[model samples]
Target: MAELRRENQKTTSELKETQKRLRQLTQTIRELEEENSILRAQALKLKEDTANRDLSFSRELQQMKEQLQEKSCHVSLSSYTHATVPTPTLSPAAKPPTPPDPGNSPIPQPSPTSPTLTPRDSPSDTHSLPAAQPLNTEPNPDRPAKPEAQVVLLMDSNGKYLDTKRLFPGLITRAKRCQNRGQAMELLRQDTLGNPQHIVVHTGTNDLHTLHRETAEAMTKMAKRASREFPDSRVVISTLLPRTDTPPHVIHEINMEISRSCAALPNIHLAHHTNIGTWDLHDGLHLNKVGVRAFAKTLKDVTLDRNPNSLAHTAAPPRNYRPPRYQQERQSNTASHLPAAPRPPAACYTLPSCPTQPQKTPPPSPMDDLRLCDEQSHPSPTH
Candidate 1:
């Protein structure tokens, strides 16, 4: 019993020692946790401080930008004022006046040598007033290059849908008679844009053969890059041609998504080239002769109609417009019957209202007369 009690006592003591050690371990763990929390708090504080500093720097940068803009605006305003002040005087001075004979025709004769246009003016604006006009306040992202001159086509092997350059003079084409879609896109991206007016992209037929997952993204990137890089150019993205490898439904969904993405981008035109007769199995991926002609004509017509440089730019005037002959005759008779006042320039004169009519002053309004009498009595004091 004594031996058993001693063994129990020893065991109890050992248990107490373990308990004490456990208590110490618990304290150590608590200290470690507290230290970790302190470290975390310090890290959080450091992050907040860094963020605050970054925010302050951004704010300062924004303020500087605003100030720079204001300064630039003021400078531009001053330059514009200085530039405009002497234009009227300079123009008349430059044109050495040789008074025409009194009996000479009023039709102006062109000088022998063509005059050089001002650096700021385009050939289209040669007839504009010689006086310096205020520059466009808004930035012109694209130069005023002629649409035909700037239009370019990037086509894959299947681009045989059209020979657009042939129909539209000065339009550029980079594709050979045949090329791969992936390679064409890479080449197109790598090629210098060189201030084009329009970029017509026809790719992705081969993407159907390749089953590339990145096709949509690649196409989207191409459109976006073209838009960003050539702000002045019109971007035209054509739908993929039918391929046996890819299901029609799959092609359609992909095309619809791509069209949506392209449509969302500014200055992008989504064109459909789903002509049934275009594709062939023997030719691998090429348009038939008939398809080629039809597609070409359609593209030519669409692009020409959209082109700013085309003669068809302005719609034909209404065919129904007829002269108001009876009314004009009556007015002429009435005018002849009455004493003639004065005739204004034909260009300035409009029908129904004569610009030469003297605006006769009213006999007198009592209020106006009173105001005039007061003004005469108390003229503004001048320094």
Candidate 2:
């Protein structure tokens, strides 16, 4: 019994030691969890700080770009003003010129061999009386007026749909046709886009057959560059038109990416052609007449700052359109297979509204007619 008691005491003491160790381990775990929570909070704070920094950087960059553009515009205007101003000059003639008389006076024309003289050519001419009219500010009737609204359309062959004559008066349209995104970029680089109100870039439909992600990136990059170049103008980017050869989801993804990029810029807008379906394309690639109408309308709206909803209304198919030939054939076959409805009974024709069918009767015989005549002539035995 003593031995048993000693063993029991030893076991109990070991159990108490394990319980103490477990408590220590639990405490350690709690401390580690607390540390992890602190680290997570610090990481979150770091992320927020980084985001704020990026936003600040972007704003600063935009401001710098605006300042640079303003400076450039000011410089160009100054240069233009200097170029248009007429410099003062002196002539030898002091008396006012008399009206020409065709009968006696012959106008003396300046000789082409003689060098034209200016104010700087001879200091002696500076003392002579200035011309009656030093400067004529009257507007020249022959000079072509500057366009009031300049819209730059950088697109593919789809640009042919927009007719320059039908557009608003004094609104000049400078359309550049590009075969692909690369060509579009190249054209943009080469073409000089003046201070236009809107810059429309419609591309990427041709590039969808390539890697979609890469195509999307290229599209976004092109839009960004255009926005950067024309900071004052509204940069309009058109979504890819639906093509039969490419899956709808691929085009959707590309558009989604482009939309996100456009949303990030303040001056960039999206001309959505998502309403255009496969039926709109003529050759599964280019837009047909209907599609071109809708496409042109969308571009016109964007260029003129009109409502975007017009595209959906204009792109809708006609209500009275006939179905495809295959569809018509299928429908005809199905109808042929359907059982015919039962015919109405003769009683249905009894109604006054219903037309009655004619009844047929046998013709009268000649022998019967002769017997009747003999009976009438005899008149004898009138019973």
Candidate 3:
């Protein structure tokens, strides 16, 4: 009986120990389940935050694209005007009167009856027109005409003042606010009219703030189009300026996209920063004074170095051209020697000398009369 009781006690102790172990395991499993739930909640929150960030970035990019487009349009228009406008040459002896700076006040228009003067006889002129005489007229036979160059600025409203102050200290910059795509288009149009040879584009900050994709697309398109439109002109597309306060991942993604876009464009050049890692920001968008100066100097050097041949091309007149002075003098001498040109005779009633047959007028052909009537008349087939 004693042996049987001892064996029973041993079995009881083993059973109690096993039960305790099982209970501990159950508690451990419950704690694991709670941890998994917390982790899942955190994952969901992260996903939602990422989604919100993406949406915000998209909106900002769209707004920026719109602004860039507007600015581009304006620039195009300005460039076109510059190309078409006739540039007048000034003579040494007949210098044009120093017109008052138009910046201080409105320019006055000359009256139609204002004293008319020829190019040679004007009192204000200090330079004389080149003579049509032989090339031997040069005082220094070995010297060639020195080439002249001018610098012009191209920018939208946000950072244009920096360009004006740094690059073109003598001249005033006409700033066009790039509020949307329409405005950017207008700016481009103006720039085209103006024919700026070197363009520095500083944009994309507002787009980041707005998270607009269209802004990037528009900017890329503009850079591409500018390459075609202004083949002679160089287009410098700046990298998206840094925003340090934003999340590291977001900033990295935005900059990566910008760099990618710039790389895709064949004609667009990326501006180099001294410190690539340093985030330079003005209100999280524009560059500060030091940044602007660095950018301007880089641009200036690039522009000056790129076009060495242009200097010689712009300096010399065409081989076939004759000087205005010779033409003028020849005309004056002819006038002095010859009788005044005869005036047209007044209408008088006179009989026809001989009867002439009326010639048959040719009828207009179908090809000659073909004209564009309406948009619908020439509808393009859908692809």
TM-score of each: 0.37, 0.44, 0.34
lDDT of 3 at 221: 68
lDDT by candidate, in order shown: 0.65, 0.76, 0.58
Tens-place lDDT digits, model 3, residues 1-79:
9999999999999999999999999999999999999999999999999999999999999999999999999877655
Give the residue spans of candidate 3 off by over 4 A.
1-152, 156-158, 161-182, 190-192, 213-215, 248-252, 262-266, 272-282, 301-383
Worst lDDT window (10 residues) for model 1? 308-317
Enumerate residue pairs that collide in model 2: none
Give Cα distance to truth, residue 9, candidate 3, Å.
99
* Higher-ranked by lDDT: 1 or 3: 1
Number of clashes in every candidate structure?
1, 0, 75
lDDT of 1 by residue, 1-383 (tens): 99999999999999999999999999999999999999999999999999999999999999999999999999898666444232433455465456577568586665669675675766644444465665545534453543333666777655654555576766554444324455545545424546666667777777764665556666787778777777776777776765544555676777787887777788777766454321333253566665566456545555554642343332232355332444457678999899988887897765685568788887887998999999999999999
**Candidate 1 structure lDDT:** 0.65
Ranking by lDDT: 2, 1, 3
Assess the local accuracy of residue 311 in candidate 1 as a C-alpha lDDT between 0 and 100.
Answer: 37
Candidate 1 runs further than 4 Å off: 1-149, 160-165, 170-191, 277-284, 305-383
